[model samples]
Target chain A: MPDSAFAEIRNLDLFAQMTDENFAALMRGAYVQNFPAQIDLISEGDPSDFLHVVLSGSVDLFSTWNGRDTSLATVRPIATFILAATVKDAPYLMSARTLEKSRIALIPSQDVRAIFDVDGNFARAVVTELAQSYRTVVKSQKDLKLRTSLERLANYVLRQQKRSGEVSSFFLECEKRRLASVLGMTPENLSRAFKGLVPYGVQVEGTRVTILDQGELERFAKPNPLIDDTSV
Target chain B: MPDSAFAEIRNLDLFAQMTDENFAALMRGAYVQNFPAQIDLISEGDPSDFLHVVLSGSVDLFSTWNGRDTSLATVRPIATFILAATVKDAPYLMSARTLEKSRIALIPSQDVRAIFDVDGNFARAVVTELAQSYRTVVKSQKDLKLRTSLERLANYVLRQQKRSGEVSSFFLECEKRRLASVLGMTPENLSRAFKGLVPYGVQVEGTRVTILDQGELERFAKPNPLIDDTSV
Candidate 1:
């Protein structure tokens, strides 16, 4: 593995505290691969043989049923996805595809579970990560069930703005179509929702979104910490 | 604490494998209480001070934003709730309430955390339980994002019948209104959906549903194990 790749993953909470010996054991079985954009990284219902760490770029976590697919989440650099399935020896619940040319570290599931058996600190970190992931999905469920497409779009823009250093304008991470899927709306509904937000002061020019009235949008969106606070 | 409660939780995978000594430590700090129906068990944003196990009866895990609320999950007997929060020392993401008079065991979070610190077995168990919880929420998210209310309700009935030992009829777990909330629909919409399913042979009278054409309903719902399998 490249020193940069090793350094990036070693710095993660999931790996930072482990003894160098055990960490070495894991990396010895690990390989870092470069995946091209839009490549299928993993498929839902496949056995989770490896725990993946996206070293750079992004991957979309999505699911499908009855010929319909929707975005479930996106995995960015320096974090792992499907740890729950790896540890539990279960099939992947969602498929992952690279949204852009990306580098990812593949650690064998056996290595992960084996180290977890001997390393209390590693096991502790696994639980912590899983807990955070569970809460995130729970929040998303609340967002989907409690909000309309318009409200969801509004809050999502506000959230992106906050993530981009509380700027007046920022870019959406996903394409509008995938963003619509992530927000549980169709492309047409997303367009209408963008139009629906004009009164509250949101302007969308392609991917660039300028918040003309932050206060008005906040009042309309009401982004609660329990649901919107990523730091939590 | 009652022996029956201890016996019940001991049978759970979360507690089943811990050393007897550690389990004793956990139980010693734990207290079991009977809550009357409709009592609030925990609220969103409240510090997660204790981990709760439902020894009997049921608890609805629900969340609210602005002026509306929806059911996120229901915890039946012989299972735990808010574990992810309790372990992370975070606020409850969803508020919980008794759906009926319930027996619940509350284990101090500190004790749970304390035991987890020293017991590898307990820590491993915690990871497995949290992983399973995460997957369950992921499946629910897929259901919400991918299916219409009518489809959700249809599958819910078929699943319930199967849960009740593949019987021809079964009592709905919650009242129609609460069921609608869980299925992400208004009561009127849920009622209409049930009527919509009448042609497929779903008969709903109060809480009891008789499936006149099981094959037809299954064909309509098209329950995939990836989405509907509780065993996974």
Candidate 2:
């Protein structure tokens, strides 16, 4: 494998256990592509032929309903997307688009399958990654189904704080509009939710948010392992 | 394996790959426990020490948020819960409680791990079962995030109709209250939604639901694979 491609594979948890030779064989026919900002990398309902690894920039995953689209998640650099579908040979569940100018590695699903079968380590790594992804989605489901819109935003802020290791402040990773959709709410409702959190010690300024009181926010959000990051 | 246990294992997809001798060894240290209705069998956040197989009756898997609990799903006879957590040695995300008088098989996680390392067929079967369980949870997440309550109920009716076959009316396997929570709606709202669905040609007579018009419900639900099934 090329040094650069090897570095890319190292970043993916699914390829964590791959031997150098196995990794090279797996990527023998794979190639990289650069996508411009806002490019639709993969559309929902399209057949998934490649297992995508985001090499650089970010990918936004969202789904449309009745002409309205909502953000499902943002795939950061060094992670794979639509992997379960790729393994299951199913169509993409949500459309993925580049949030900024990005580069992605495309490995044919057939190669992935072939390599996966021969590499127990690779298969185990895939199992772990897929399980984590599955848990994250389930947590997101619990968030959507169990919490009100305001509660969701409050918890989201604390989760970002935990991710950044800055209890007081963290920059918003995406637009409020997109964030709202990801949280399963309307943009206007998300705006209103921000205002609602003022009493809970949250302050939002443009794309940067500051938490004035962590305890108060936690009291309102009630962060749990299923919803927020304790290990990270 | 005992004759009765052998007959039971035959019905489970997870154990379908096992030969009789292989299965007997796997079950050598396994034990069975019977749970009465409404018993809390497994609590969330506890260590996953054993792999649970529902031998009879049913189980309700759910998570709590802010002192209120939301139903995640139900497990009928012969299904397993927390397999991923068991394999990964992670904390349980959702608690499992008996919904009916039940018989459950518990195999120590250590025993499962031991058998998994030596039995290639069992290892493959375990991975396959974990992958499928993970995908089902992912699909449930899609069900929660990508659809409104009414849409969820509509799609749920279709799913139940499919599960129970083309009968005019079929009894719900679980309680209406738990079903309401699983569908992410209030009992009151579920009641109103049932009334609202009269136009869609679905009728809920007690726990016996009749899909009077499948075409209308399908159109109204707009069931997409990504949102409905097979997306994960």
Candidate 3:
């Protein structure tokens, strides 16, 4: 692996507290690889063997059932995916695929488990990361259960705008079909949902969304911090 | 707390690996309380100060928005709720209430965090518990996203049947209204859903359910371990 890659891994919250020796030991058995867009990185029900860290580009975590699939989450640059699965030595509950040409570091899960047993700081970091991940998912569930699909779409647009540096308008980072899956709606429903938000001052032209009336949308979406806030 | 309470807490997977001294210290600030049926225990948006462990009976975790409410999960005996919130010192995302007369232990979140930082075994145990909790919620989301309400109801009956010691007939432990909320449906929709399942050999009378044809039900439910398994 390159020195830059090591620095990237070292900088994540999951590794910031680890001793240099332990971090080096973990990296000793790790490697970095690049994959083309749309390639399957991992599949659900497969035994988790490596802790994957996305160094660049993006990966979509999704679940499949009865020949249908839904997007669970998207992992962007400089974050780890499937840490919980790796920590528990459990099967991947969600399958992952690269959304674009992406670079990722794969650390042996066995090394992670072994080092976690002896490194107190590493263990604490793992607990904190896992706990944060768990809480984020809980929040997502609350949002799904409590909000209507139209409200969900409105808030999602707001969130995406904020994520894209608080711009007044921004292009959606994913396709509308995938966005519909992520929001737990049919593509037809998503189209109708966007139209429903027109009265709330949301303008959708292709993938570009402009929040014309932020206040109106917020009032309608009622985005609760407990459910919408992503920061730990 | 009584001796039996201590034994129950110690036996939980989260505390099973902690040193006895640390366990005793945790108990120093912990207390057990009893609540009557249908009592609200904790509300969403409240600061998480205690890690609640249900000693006996059951607790229903649910959420509300815009005058509508839905069940999130049911916490039975010998399990913890809000561990992620307690660990992260964040506000509870879901409100918890007792479904019946129940005994519960409340441990100060500070003590849990303190021991977690110093005790490696305890830290590992927290990671395992948190990871397992994360996976369970992820599975629930997959179920929500990938399956229609009818399919979810079908699979839920199968799961409940398995949980009730694989009995062919078992009483629905919760009220029909609460079960409807948990299944993310209205009481009317749930009524229709139960009727929809009759073709698969499911019979419902009041709170009683009998799976007359497990084979037919399984074929329709398509229960996948990745989405349904509770065990870590």
For B55-85, candidate 2 gives per-residue lDDT tens digits of 8899998998777899887888778888777
Model 3 ranges with Cα > 4 A deviation = none
In CAPRI terms, where does candidate 2 land?
A: acceptable
The residue pairs in collision within model 2 are: none
TM-score of A-chain in each prediction? 0.98, 0.94, 0.97
Instruction: Output DockQ, candidate 3.
Output: 0.81
Cα lDDT for residue A106, model 2?
Answer: 92
Model 1 ranges off by over 4 Å: none
Better of 2 and 3 by lDDT: 3
Q: What TM-score does structure 3 among the candidates reach?
A: 0.98
Docking class of 3: high
The residue pairs in collision within model 1 are: none
lDDT by residue (tens digit), candidate 1, A1-232? 9998999999999999889999999999999999999999999999999999999999999998899999999999889999999999889999999999999999999999999999988999999999999999999999999998888888899889989999999998789999999999999999999999999999999999999999999999999899899867
A1-232: candidate 3 lDDT, tens digit per residue = 9999999999999999999999999999999999999999999999999999999999999999999999999999899999998988999999999999999999999999989998989999998888888888888888888888998888898889878998888999999999999999999999999999999999999999998998998999887787788874
- Candidate 2 lDDT, tens digit per residue, A1-232? 3578668677677886678888878788888888999999889888888999988899998777667677878999789998876766777777899999998999998888777767767767776777677677777878887789998898889888878886587899888888988888889999999999999989999988999988898888888886665341
User: Cα miss at B12, model 1 (Å)?
Assistant: 2.4
